[model samples]
Target: MLDSGAVAEPFEREWFMRHPMRVAHDLVGAMLVVDRNGDQVVARIVEVEAYGGMEDLASHATMYRVGRETIGSAPGVLYMQRSYGLHTMTNIVAHE
Candidate 1:
């Protein structure tokens, strides 16, 4: 766990522009800090799923219109997905 005063340096826009697999590697075992309203939440990264783009059959880009737009857009696009018939996971689009 991070100390209450721990400060994280935000990554540059170029960082997310890399291929999704590389980003996934960088995310493993890293720290993620999120601040919403007045609450701050910190979590450790374990796993990630990467999508390359239209060529990636499993990517949203090949499934729907919005998928093409969002997945092809900049790196920080957010979308929703129902995983394993269990829960909906919020997804952030990252691609080169």
Candidate 2:
């Protein structure tokens, strides 16, 4: 899950600290897996949030200490953190 073409986002650790509104609706193509007793559940990601990586201080991207240009260049990065025993997540859009 951390490899493949999908590398870990420098922002991966930040999204969890932000406020969450509605994620389940946005996560369509993204994989959603859960263990219910002995059963496993999974789904795709469809929707997500925007973490202005270069500008947002509370972003995992900020932790990298990369130059503004480098940070801004990153795209398709995803961040997820579980809170209160709940999962919180978001993504970074590609720069066009």
Candidate 3:
């Protein structure tokens, strides 16, 4: 059971519109919420990695240019891709 007053305010799009490094840093200690079948699950974000476009050699954008539409789009959008053709990697798009 949860109290209505215990709920935290949601992060806005502007909250994720900063530099990837900054966003990653700020994401620490944040809470991630998942609602499934009327059940809500909450998890704390402990760490995050920032990936800049073009310049970041490790960034998927370097190899997958087609993803720019979502990765370079507005903030708060989910950027997902398959890694090593096995695991699905999910990320939040940061600043342009």
Best by lDDT: 3
| lDDT of the candidates, in the order given | 0.74, 0.46, 0.78
State the number of backbone clashes in model 2. Answer: 11
RMSD of each: 2.5, 11.5, 3.1
lDDT of 1 by residue, 11-68 (tens): 6667887778988788787676678998978777677778778898997669777677
TM-score of each: 0.73, 0.29, 0.74
lDDT of 2 at 38: 94
Candidate 3, residues 1-96, lDDT tens digits: the string is: 335577688889998888888988988887878799999888777767888876788877777865655666788777668877898766788884
- Please tell me which predicted candidate would have the highest TM-score against the true structure: 3
Q: Model 3 off-target regions past 4 Å?
A: 1-5
Which stretches of candidate 2 lie above 4 Å from their native place?
1-42, 65-93
After superposition, the stretches of candidate 1 with alpha carbons farther than 4 Å from their true spots are 3-5, 64-66
lDDT of 2 by residue, 23-82 (tens): 323344556455699996554556654445556776555664333434454444434444
Clashes of each: 0, 11, 0
Which residue pairs clash within candidate 1? none
